[model samples]
Target: MNATDRLTELFMRFPGIGPKQAKRFVYFLLREHFHFKEQLINALQELKHTGKQCERCYSFFGDKNLKNPKSKCHICLNENRDEKILMIVEKELDLDAIEKTGSYNGQYFILGGVLPPLTEKPSELIRVRELVARIYDDITNDSLEEIIFALPVTDYGDVTKEYLEKTLGQIVGMKNIKMSTLARGLSSGLELEYVDRDTFKSALERRQ
Candidate 1:
């Protein structure tokens, strides 16, 4: 394939980008100024090196003066944020949406992805083991009290939540952690990343 075709193909790999949209992106980039392309390339190249994932919550942050290789993100390191409440989200975008609501002042764990039904060893698909470990660690060390499931309002989200509820319930001492999900303010099939802040806030407030 030529450069244009190869680039379009790569763009198509992005979530929700169809072949036509991907081609449009390629042509748009081709028409952009040389400096724009240079800047985009530079940013993409520096992304991995500049950003580091927090050891505690697994959220990525850009810290130029980071001293420790396993440093926590600002939210995890904050003294005021409630360590007892941990919210589990599917992706960083969902986390961003929740933060924008300004209703939740607690720690978060990004699952990286949602689990689909019939997937063998569902724990391997997302950060289930890591989340379990974190829950235990926080319960023992940080006085964890509750865990909120902030996944999208989709079939996969429900499946993942049910799996977590069942599995985590079996862990010793985890019974004390009050688990809840975002309320019905989120319509069926709605993703947390796309939900309005007001609706998200209402769901958060009504979470049981």
Candidate 2:
């Protein structure tokens, strides 16, 4: 394939992007100044170099000019954040939306993705084992009291949430840990990443 076709194909790989939109993006780039292309390439390269995943929460954060850049992200390093409450999310975008609300001040764990119904080995699809291990470690090492499932309201999200609740509840120490999810303020079929701040705040407040 030619440069234009190859670029469009690559852009189509992004979620929600179709062939027509990807083609538009490619043509838009072609019409832009050469310096703009250079800037975009530089930014993409810098993303990989500057981004670091927090060991504890597994959230990606940029450590641009910090003294100890290898350390955890700001949220995880903050002593004021509630270590006793852990919020589980489907992806980084969901975590970002929750943070934008400024309502939740607890630790977070990104499940990476939700489980698809057709997948035979559902546990292998997401970070299930890692999440369980983290919960166990937190209960033993930290003052973990609650685990909030902050997944989307979709069917797959519900499936993953139920699976986690069942599996985690079976753990000896997890019996006392309070488990909850976002309230019905989040309409069914709406993903957490697209939830408005007011709706997110209300759902968080009414989380059961």
Best candidate, TM-score: 2
How well does model 2 score by local distance difference test?
0.85
Across 11-124, the per-residue lDDT of candidate 1 in tens digits comes to: 999999999999999999999999999999988877766788888788888776746665788898889998888899999998887787787899999998888987788877
Off by over 4 Å in 2: 65-71, 172-175, 186-190
lDDT of each: 0.84, 0.85
Q: What is candidate 2's lDDT per residue for 1-208, written digit by digit as tens?
A: 8999999999999999999999999999999999999999999888877778888788988888656746588998999998989999989988888888788899999999887666677678888888888888887776788888988777788888878887898773444888998787635555678778788888888999
Candidate 1 collision pairs: none
> In model 1, what is the error at residue 108, expressed in angstroms?
0.7
Candidate 1 overall Cα lDDT vs. reference?
A: 0.84
- Give the TM-score of each candidate: 0.87, 0.87
